[model samples]
Target: MTRNNYAPYITISREEWAKRSDDPMLHLLNDFETLQGLNEPLTMEEITQIYVPLSRLLNLYVSGAQRLHAATNSFLGSQFLKVPFIIGIAGSVAVGKSTTARVLQRLLSAWPNHPKVDLVTTDGFLYPNKVLEQKGIMNRKGFPESYDIRRLIQFLANVKSAKERVSAPVYSHLEYDILPNELKWIESPDIVIVEGVNVLQVRPRQQQKEPTIFVSDFFDFSIFVDAEMEDLQQWYIDRFKSLRQTAFRNPESYFHRYAHLSDKESEVIATNIWNEINRPNLELNILPTRFRASLILEKGGHHFVQSLKLRRI
Candidate 1:
């Protein structure tokens, strides 16, 4: 059965909210510390306070998946039962899904068994800006309809089918578009993290109406990053400001026009874009998929995940 077609099932949990400390999982995360980009890497307090616990929890999920795979293999008596564990990470734009995916990919790969992890982002499937402009969907960039959903689904299907080589388009944030003819290839990986604003979103129509395949259908696990709308808006504006000073200043950047704006002007433009475009897409398409994820990482104003709501077993 396809992942999405399965009935809603919960992972067996050892406790309501399991906490971990000083697990071997931390050793696998050595490279992940560099990715975090925090100054004074490997501070004793940081390890005890954060990575140790998160990695431990992830280790549990990985262990559980291995057991399931073993069981399925025994039942089928097939040697071809192996496949990369597929994960879906979804959230509104600027809600820090990228960071979460990066961290998870690095930490998860630290395990001795699954040393190869790959991350594929849905932004790669977004229609080129020129196409969106021609289609009058420039304002609907993050909406479900703005993506090449069929191709995205096919890509996931290819990966899940264990294709020897799979290629995907690449997106450029500075250009704010999908670069034509640019692609990233995956020969094989132990794990694949597919992250995007709508990674878990189903097509708008019901199955009986059109029977479409969603990109989310291939996930073994899914995560939704959520925060208060107000907090999200603030975060979006903050990120936009940072981008303006960095990416937008690049001569080849599509958003170079914003580089000349005054700070106040930039803030105004950012807020307007968020309200008229991003917020609407999040409300109409993305946020609605929260219930579809295996876990919800709810963040606070500080951009830290304050609570995790895992599906009840």
Candidate 2:
């Protein structure tokens, strides 16, 4: 069967993309042990074949953006503050987006022109557990509504405006809640990467007419990780099991109870969570925004990126 055409996006196989360069930077996979996600085995081959080219492409965009800024400043006869180039990465839960963000952060920072790079997740913008409980949306924690949309928008606005010493609330994965009085300071960075499931979501209707701003509006480029739903479900379950063996085993872990369960019992719980919560969010909220991405990394089984779809200039 022939694959469907993704118009306006040039799709290329992994092998073809690999041939673009043979630079040593492309084969820097020694850090894979730290960058790989739970239950996700990212190989050096994949990095050289897939992510290296992606980093180079982003470098070009960053360079172009810098040149444009310089030209605009010259035309206006004013030296405006340099705004950071922001990249947004969106995907379903357990789709290895965090790993992708981390890898890109490392790669982008290594570039001489943009040595100062930072990464922040929308998880930090999520409503506190107390707030979610008060709103009766605790179970829908990763949904769009579960975030403090106004604060998130403001945070991005500050960053894009070149505001100094901007800080965001910090969230603890182990406690599964926002930490009071804790902040992640974001100084002026050459590049900032924002990763989340809902980064590509459209602005809410109430603000649609009023200077319309979205989290994505601040993004100079965006990426969406893609995979078959069945594959994603399996990956989610696998990650859950791996966490149970590690992080979830901690007594303070929000999911500590699952750590002691038998393999079959844990599998049942993971499956139910995926089917009841994650799958619905992906179908209704996340997957719908995939077409909005500047690039789509289509992964096959075993977390291997098989093809890439890049929007045509």
Candidate 3:
């Protein structure tokens, strides 16, 4: 996603992209906190350069979709369920996709009922740890196979159809597993932001196989957050170390074993985990899906997005 496109995008510099927003109320975002997530240094400046214009663009898209849906219903002399505008945001581990989702959810929700915004992460749809252990894929947790693809597809379908009450499985980072009998209930919202590493992925089948549906198939727009391989590795290690002192220190946390480790030991373990699991998943699975996204946010040093590549077609 990072500059790895096929000449189909209109590359915009960070300065120029920031200029796209002429809102007099642009100063409101200066105090809004998008600088969230572990080890993610998202300054207010980054928001103005990236998300402000992006959110403005999304507002227009949502408005246009509403108008088009109303026109269709008027022309047919009947009412149709309003389909929600779904935005899928994808990225590698520790790439700050969650922060992006939260920022957009907050910004979009400010308009009240004009567009009720909801945020959901595909992590909730990942199979339980027990299920993964049974499938012998516990080590491949973030890979595509770790997910309950069918259930994720059904959830997205229900959301798009504006189902009265749709619910998704709840995942617990503390437990590192899907919570038993717990769910995240989602009512019909005007816009839904689905964020996860697997959002933009596409799996090609054997030549004789029948065509099938993909999670991205339901997305009206998709974004892929991209960075160099080394940067991602470092970020993952940093986050892991930070979590050890924080979340992993909780006795109920799944990673409690690493809480007491020295900084050197923590770094070593984190590096090993990245090498054995995360790196392979990124190189083999995640990176290949980058070009499939409608927009690509490419970051350089310091985790700041250097430019944006928006698909022209």
Q: lDDT of all the models against the reference?
A: 0.78, 0.90, 0.87
Write one digit per residue (lDDT tens) for candidate 1, span 1-313: 6576554545423232335465555665555556642211234344444545555666677778878888888888876746777889999988878777877777777766678889999989999988899999898888888898878988988888988789999998877889897999987887899999988877556546766677778998888888999988988888788778888899999899998888899899999999999999889888889989988877777776656666755
Model 2 residue pairs with clashes = none
For each of the candidates, the C-alpha root-mean-square deviation to the true structure, in angstroms, is 5.4, 3.0, 3.5
Candidate 3: minimum summed lDDT over ten consecutive residues — where? Answer: 22-31
TM-score of each: 0.86, 0.95, 0.93
User: Candidate 1: how large is its RMSD?
Assistant: 5.4
Per-residue error for 122 in candidate 3, Å, reads: 0.8
Model 1 Cα shift for residue 168 (angstroms): 1.0
Q: Pick the candidate with the highest TM-score.
A: 2
How much is the lDDT of residue 34 in candidate 3? 44
* Candidate 2 C-alpha error for residue 17, in Å: 1.1
lDDT of 3 by residue, 231-307 (tens): 99999999999998899999999999999999999999999999999999988999999999999999985998899
* Runs with alpha carbons beyond 4 Å of true place in candidate 3: 1-6, 22-35, 111-113, 204-211
Q: Model 3: how far is 213 from its true place, Å?
A: 0.6
Q: Residue 306 of candidate 3: its Cα lDDT?
A: 90
